[model samples]
Target: MRVARTLTAGLLAAGALFTVSGAAVADAPAGTKGQNGDPTEAGTSFRTATAVKQDQKATADGTTGDYLYWQFPAGAGQRPTAKATVKLPEASARHGAATWQLDVFDGLRRRQACAEGEQTKRVSQQDATVTLSCTLRAVRPYAERWSNDPLPGAYYIRLTVADGPDQDMGLPVHAEVEATAEDAGGKYAEGGELGAPLHAGAVSEPEDGWNGSWWSDRWLWTVGGAVLGALAAIGGYTLTRRPRRA
Candidate 1:
């Protein structure tokens, strides 16, 4: 009886461990940003925008009236949230309070509407920093229609110092941008890829239209769950079994 109890406890512990490990794996981000760059001539012109990824930080510097641009991929049926945080140096007479605006644009450079709050903020000498965040609902490509609707593709985030001290012009102010997206039920391929000319890494070519690593991870978790289930059943049986006659 003591041996059975010990075995049961060991099995239960192993099952718990497997469960925790699987959860950790599932919580891991689907992709990572491996490269960063700054925009050229910013503003509404997305042709010179930098490429970035979700949760990946990119830095740029600009002054009042100057705009910075960055782009990230958005898959179909996946909601994406983009955020930009600006940090200004110790405020001086030359650089005082300022209001910043963040705008989201599609591949065509057309502004996309936000599904949540406004993407603008006012930072002052006391604050010295400000962050702008915007969330967009799942975007779908227009089919059999002529609409200027936003589609799933390279999405641009444009940041501009809308109002600030004129003396602060040409002085560098730091800005960090990040983007994240919700899972899309495995509809799109995993591991994001950049558009072109921006080297993040050697983009993986799809094999039979599915990511092998993603499927492998799924298979591993499934096997682990099955093993854990079997161990649980064995442990329960051992705990409930009758003892042999003396």
Candidate 2:
């Protein structure tokens, strides 16, 4: 009984959060300035990741090698990208070159592949700033487990030094980060219907999503598998049959 009640309460809380977030996103026009001042701090891990909205600039101070974490919401049908810059301490205080890296992860904490942009960079000690960017693949409504496709949820951004001189390890640093998404309307393949996959589960959605018709890739793969199975069956039958002898 306790377990059941706990689950129910968790689900209710999740639903409330989703509805409130959706309503807020709906009322706020895209690309509009935020009503509050910009964020000035970031978290150190996924659970504590500071929440940032799309297009908002994030600033934070930390040790050179510390991993800075921030998170932003994403919905289906949007291609999200994360960009960040690390301003190093005075060049004179450095002893050698350093390598910086930026990483983006999905709600599942899975590292996302950057379709474009310099996700890593090597900067000389004389360099004052390191620029990094990661453009992740578009988020989908639902995908097969094996596909490991990105889904709508909170995406986290991590900034850290991949390599640096010992002297730079604890040096003070400032960073700026931001996340953005593009409105790429739901597209379909030639044979697949508008929404053949038929989104059977609940999910977060972008402002301009075809919520009613969220399906495609899933059906395409299903159709492809059926074709392959038919071909294999015919091949197996041909191999098993013996040629008729007169």
Candidate 3:
């Protein structure tokens, strides 16, 4: 009965937290100005996730839910290889088995681009109460099957929740996917040919992201919650165990 009560309290608290967070995300208006005193996305990106090929669904339980995230590179097709790291939210309800995959695609302008690099994980059943979340990051690498082969243009990355059902929780995540593949050779491929002069248009800075104080507070709260939950679980288990009568 004691254990049940503790668990119930923890769950209720977590649910309340999630509700509050969702409301904040949905109802919060545009953030104020940054250090530069200009309105920005503020810890969010202009780029929104879309299913170029298929939808990637996700779910997060307390401590063992699976996480899903993906990324793509700028010269994705120009390089012979590619790689990405997917960061999972803390208190992920996923456990046990996990996996990642890479998909290639072609995009607008008949330009050569690599498709999104994908990552996935499948956790087995666990009894431990997941009080807090953890970052579950998966780093996977890929090399073009064909040498000197150019990838398709407009690459995209998507993650899918593949296993472990948790109370119908949308895979809560704070993920960022950016190009990490450096040009293998000083030379670049253009018009499907090698040894072409690199054009300035081929390289340009990505969109400016929002950076402000409010988002920092949100992240700090998330971190603090995870830490407190872990500690509570450890202490609760130690103290609440049945005393073995002699």
Candidate 4:
């Protein structure tokens, strides 16, 4: 009877363990980048284009203009709901080459996709218009944008390309992203009202030896049961062999 009770207790523990393990695994995000696992409170934040890249300049070709670019985090890529622009300074006369390429980065990797206008430039202004409007949906793969990925921490945005001559015109570009933080609506540019800084706890692919996440938890519970069973057996033998007084 005692053995039966102990076995029942072990089974109950195993069940409880499975429940916890399942819950933890289920709570994990769904995507190729989040297999490793991230913390509960981890969230996304927006950074300015200048924050990612700097040093704006016009090309010597006299056909291109200054510009900036950045990649969006995977899965959380967002399409621009409204038109936005960054103020640019006066540079050498580049007739129609001044343009911006709002591209998305390859998932947590160092590759980028130029799924937008190939040659972009700000429209000629009567006054000094430093800003350029960026239409999000106008870019390719609008459905798969950074806002959709929603990683939990800091990721990089790279300057993949700037409008310039067709060839031999790979001059460095410079530009700054307008900060939308602390805006009038009590919200920031990142679309989040909290104005949170891009954090650095995003969950990515799991590293070596950690692939057995769910199974590992199950194994631990099973091993614990075996240990308890062995101990119970030893106790029963000892009690049966005990000497009795007359």
Those runs of model 1 whose alpha carbons end farther than 4 Å from true positions after fitting are: 1-45, 93-95, 141-144, 184-246
Tens-digit lDDT string for candidate 1 (3-110): 999999999999999999987655432232334433222232354566665656777666656778777776544567889887776666445777789988776666
Ranking by lDDT: 2, 1, 3, 4
Q: What residue runs in model 2 are displaced by over 4 Å at the alpha carbon?
A: 1-36, 188-246
**CA-lDDT, candidates in order:** 0.64, 0.76, 0.33, 0.32
> Worst lDDT window (10 residues) for model 4?
179-188
Q: Give lDDT tens digits, candidate 3, residues 1-246.
A: 999999999999999999999876754433333364333221211132121111112221122132222223233223322332334443445443333332322222122334332233343333222111111111112223343233322333333334544542443433322333322321222223212212212122212111101223345567999999999999999999999999
Checking candidate 2 for backbone clashes, the offending pairs are none
RMSD of 4: 28.2
TM-score pick, better of 3 and 4 = 3
Q: What is the lDDT of candidate 2?
A: 0.76
TM-score of each: 0.56, 0.64, 0.31, 0.27
The alpha-carbon deviation from the true structure for residue 97 of candidate 4, after best TM-score superposition, in angstroms, is 4.0
Per TM-score, the best of the predicted structures is 2
Error of 1 at 241 (Å): 38
